[model samples]
Target: MLKHSQIWRAIDRLAESKGLSPSGLARRAGLDSTTFNKSKRTTREGKPRWPSTESIAKILQATNTSLAEFTALVEGDGIGRPAPQTLPLIGFAQAGQAGYFDDAGWPVGAGWDEIRTPEVTDPHAYALEVSGDSMQPVYRDGDILVVAPDEAPRRGDRVVVRTMEGEVMVKELLRLSEKRVELKSLNPVHDDRSLAREQVEWIARVLWVSQ
Candidate 1:
């Protein structure tokens, strides 16, 4: 028996797996932004409104999800199950400020949002929303980047570096040594920067990016 609640929950889970809000998923599917909104899920009298089969099909196609996979979710069978872990999400602008992270670079304190993403190797993985045009061409405003604090960044890996002076930046690791680290900007208009090792508070590798 297919329950309405189960189907709706499966849709919500699908959106989460893609690192999107329900409206984001709808927009990706070429549907109205409010198509899957909570308010649209019920009538003015509070009656449950079911999702159309066409809408479900469109979302599945847009997300590249198979019907079998979506069915498993609706049936609670766990096929192609999403990551069980939830990561803390903060804007890149706010990440530079103090009190958001502890000494180890793990997220701390309030004002942090949450997102469900695929399983990350690092338990200290977190997400940052790109803001402004600093990292443009590679990362734009509203893009979400998943970073792993526990993973050591090697040469050529994209990384997020925080300085003791409360400056945070995303750059590609060009070189590293006991004395200083060289960072390359993703945008050609920006110049490369070098920071002394002692000045860096933490350096975390960017594991994934959701545009």
Candidate 2:
């Protein structure tokens, strides 16, 4: 669950990362200087008042930060920069081909290249070179998607799913039930998908995108 304190702390950390104060962040976002003031974080009765989604969006755009990165901050997932880590890399087009991944979706076999991603700690992590416009407006063509096959996919998390029919796709996980998994398309024009549990060969959480 997301907490109001986490959102505010993420804002503070974001401001600090950019060498700005809360007021400066707000101002840079074209919002009032007092928009993020500590005094306004609560009501007169002392209840927590969360920041507006619009405000968060504005600050993210102002800081040139990705939502995944910001979510990481909110979740406190990053623990400073660790040594660079290398992972097996393959193109999105090749993901559907056999021999690249095991039955459990872990990367395997030859024809795989290597990519260095900072702070990626998953030993089973792999990179997929995104192609085409099917996942645009979020993941662009040529963007590198870091996938953690070991991480469990949660609702609203970006994920990679491979069907038993040899199709690989990236979509937002919508719902997971005993019988089926629902996915929401990243591109508005693309239709959503619903796959039976048996039809889904594997599902992995997308940790982040390196654009």
Candidate 3:
């Protein structure tokens, strides 16, 4: 039997996968903004209130998702259930320090915090909290950036590059070649840099950011 909490969690996950809040999802489904609000999950008398099939159908349509995909969500296989997806989170300042990441630019060792995020394709993806104003305008301090080490960054994509010398930077890719790569800093105050491909320990693509 389907539990109330499980179904509600599946809705929550559906919203997250589309990068929308619960209220956003409800609005997109042509319902009241508070339809899926946590407070509405139960009645005034504290009895659990379940989402109607009609509402679920509306949401699935709004998200351009199929019933099978929604069912997979309910089963915790597509995106959301009760349990959360955990990712290693580290501050940008601390990330520059040694021992936090392996030579391949994947998170390793200790001094790392865990954050629960929605399902992503890359199992090795990690989160980095912006600390300084170096990446302002586009990304501010306190923003969370999700990096996928296994994803190769294409030209014009934002990426995080770590050097063999322990220098870590977030920049936009201008050009890449067999021997070197050109990078443009997000902040105009910072000058663009070019590094030999050999000098870079690893370059990971920034998949998502929470402002």
Candidate 4:
């Protein structure tokens, strides 16, 4: 778990890296203008309130940050590392096709630049573009997801899992066992899937989504 202060500091660092004030960052992220205001960090009674997940997502999207990067920024270890390559933003429907991204996950074009992101402790952090409506309501057709490979899988956690056959999907982990894992979609119109453990090549918990 992350402390509230750490989260706030990360937000501040992100703004600083971008040469903007906290309120400026909030505006860029499409959130309330007061989102990162120091006065809003705590209540008049001296209680603390953390930024909402939605707000964080907005900030990540506006800043081109991955979940891994944000986690590092919150921890306060250090900064000034090279930024992540700005990848192509594609819709989920295009995911099944070939040649969109390289094997290393870099977008296949010169139209890329680096964006400041918090450091991520999890070694397995990766980003994926949403593909289909099977994950609607919770995830739209074009949302970007950041998965944490080092995080333990648990019920109720959103995850990015790939089958041994090379198909990858994003969904919520509902149940897990030695034999199989059950995944449910956020959209009620989609039914759940249960896949045998042997069929999975990799599974990672989703830490954040930039919609």
**TM-score of candidate 4 on Cα atoms, chains taken together:** 0.48
lDDT of the structure predicted as candidate 4: 0.65
RMSD (CA, Å), each prediction: 18.0, 15.2, 16.3, 14.9
Candidate 4's C-alpha runs over 4 A off are 1-118
Show the lowest summed lDDT stretch of 10 residues, model 2.
75-84
lDDT of 4 at 39: 48
Descending-TM-score candidate ranking: 2, 3, 1, 4
Lowest summed lDDT over 10 consecutive residues: which window, candidate 1?
38-47
- Model 3 regions lying over 4 Å from their true place: 1-84
lDDT of 4 by residue, 120-163 (tens): 44322445677657787888776777655435556888877667
> TM-scores of all models?
0.60, 0.61, 0.60, 0.48
- Residue pairs with clashing backbones, model 2: none
| Model 3 vs truth, CA RMSD | 16.3
Q: What TM-score does model 2 achieve against the real structure?
A: 0.61
